[model samples]
Target chain A: MKFGPMKPQRRNRLLLVLFVVLAAASAVGLALSALNENMNLFYSPGQITAGEAPTGVVIRAGGMVVAGSVLRATESLRVDFVISDLQGADVNVSFTGILPDLFREGQGVIARGILGRDGNFVAEEVLAKHDETYMPPELVDVLPDSHNDPETFKGGTRQ
Target chain B: MRFFSLPDYQLIMLNWFHRLGAPRSFYEISGRLLPVLWVLSGLSILTGVIWSLGFVPEDYQQGNSVRIMYIHVPAAIVAQSGYAMMAVAGAVFLIWRIKIADVALQCAAPIGASITFLALVTGAIWGKPTWGTWWVWDARLTSTLVLLFLYLGIIALRSAMENRESAGRATAMLALVGVVNLPIIKYSVDWWFTLHQPSSFSLGEKPAMPAEMWIPLLVMVLGYYLFFFTLWATRMRVEILNREFRTDWVQRLVVGS
Candidate 1:
């Protein structure tokens, strides 16, 4: 009887609550999409193995910066490097923005912004993906054996 | 296309309002006046649509998107000023125990929320072409968004209570406390390092816009105020009747109907 059209309409508090929630969610989605004019693709090296990256997707490629591949300009602050997930394939990244002082070769980095038409990753922003002594919430699912104790911190050496 | 300097508008409107808040007089008057006010509201809205959509010249920089200014800026100003009026009414109600002021505060909350919503939506639409983003954590936008939440909170608080008097007093306290945030919300952009552009629609200084643009905007402002007056009056009439059902005036009206 409740399902029929002729049925007496109840207060339907659940419907009202859902309406409010959906309205708020849509508004927030619109607001955020407007905030960042550009979008970034997030992936590890394995995802790119099947095919080459599309021509114009702004992406965050997570990888280890190969040691000695970091060629810092002596006069200028520009740093040139190659990033690979230790999975054989690598991409060159160029950044002119302020690089964090701790940034060095063989550390994990997430470089965001567009992949240049010329096959280079044109990084608009770069953040150091430093490993912590204590476990982090973000690392929970990603780590297979991340011990909670400091001394039990296992090898995280980059290839 | 043309501007009219009608100095008599506000003065004439004030006389109409003098009888409006008087419960018995307005309850008797609305039957005769409702049609005229409704028609006037429709006409004013239609004229705004025609002028803002087709008549006004496009901004050199903003082009067609600037037309949204007619709705967004007017709504934002209404939203802010309406909340301020409600807070003042809340104070009057609390201090003087005026039922009419309480009714006014009760009626203002939802309308303020709607106006705030209209402002945010139009601002976002306009932002797409102008700021290259729809949402920015710029102080003005952030504060205005907070204002929308405050209006919502007041409405919810009022409705949550079963007793009318308790609801009114409770909401009045909240509105008064919220009043301090108004100045902060208004000047937040000036005080903070924000991505939002500084206020262009100022109340004090002469506006930077050409007379043609500002004149129509001024007309729209008048029209919005008139619309608000008309609604407030009608809603107050209904409230007075419902609250004072046992009174002779309400009894007479009920018999007349």
Candidate 2:
């Protein structure tokens, strides 16, 4: 594909330099924006009351599983529960998905969504029951565990 | 660290960035930064696992398994970004013929390959629990896996060439051709319906995690990016110093040794 002498080498070089500079700039840009994201809004309930929680925005409320909060619905697929920031704020969350085997009365959980106009925290996504092992990230843990098998939790069988 | 940090930290960090402006400053820096970067990368990753696994809450929908997002999401992001860095580096190398670009591409290809591999493996792990299988032909999943192979291909081709210029050009051509995968991987879920989920951690949408969960994940991601930079700067430094060894500055720097 060599054409007598003038190839696009010069142009290619210019474009390459432009791209590299752009990449480094973008990485720096992402980092800067990450830093600018409100810091005070991050702490949990105890931190919230201590004047540590930043105001004016509806931020994620996180915490441990509260005992006696789980209730299976009498009617539909709905299951209801509450998670506390452990700092003292309790957010009631509702979901209709198949419950994971590891879900229990006292465990960590985080739900994304928001505080509904009705005051309940609505979660579009929920993560339940975590452990201290390295697992691939996704909708479920890749590690082998009994949670995937439903019998361990209580009366339920693996679905 | 104190014994070494006060006297050496700034001197070392500056020397690397300065040499980054040149292709050669890397030789001096790589010796120091590689161990540190590798340590940090591995450590932060483990830390992320510990915190998310123990402290983070279970998703209302996914339940206990939801923690997989911590590793899968970040690895996938890093894979795409690393390839992008390599492509940009290739483009720069082609244009300016700067050894820095060449060093970047060389160092980047392997790292990108590794990150791509991590993404695929993690995605599979995640998919198995949710998608009901270890592998999916989903647009997002397939494209990302392809990205990994493409990285390996470029690296192999680069090594296959006898002449450095020819190798750079050949690999550059491959990278350019492969650039299409970038957009495809990005919009794959939107481009076609796939089993793989849409991005959960995005800026525009409502964030899915409470402050406690996502913050740790974000920190882990930053640590990964910094780890990459630290590695790149070190590798580039080593490369430049080695290549420029015959020059007057090299002679003096070596003589000063």
Q: TM-score (0 to 1) for chain A, all models?
A: 0.53, 0.47
Cα lDDT over the full model 2: 0.63
Per-candidate interface DockQ score: 0.02, 0.05
Off by over 4 Å in 2: A1-159, B1-19, B26-43, B245-256
Off by over 4 Å in 1: A1-159, B1-22, B29-36
Candidate 2 lDDT by residue in tens digits, B132-215: 457644456767888998999998998889998888877876776677678768765443324444454556765544566677
lDDT of 1 by residue, B87-149 (tens): 878766665456777888888888888888999999888766654457655557877898898
**Candidate 2, residues A1-159: lDDT per residue as tens digits?**
121344577766666655655575576447534643332112233433444434444454445567799888988878788766543566677877665444566655444455654446655545442422222245345334422211112111112
Worst 10 residues of 2 chain B by lDDT: B189-198
Residue B71 of candidate 2: its Cα lDDT?
Answer: 77
lDDT (CA) for every model shown? 0.64, 0.63
What is the iRMSD in Å for candidate 2?
15.3
Q: Which digits, one per residue and each the tens of the lDDT, describe model 1 over residues A1-159?
A: 112243222334334334543565566557544642222223444434434455577766556677789877888867889877665667788887677533567656667767766667777766544332222234445655422211111112111
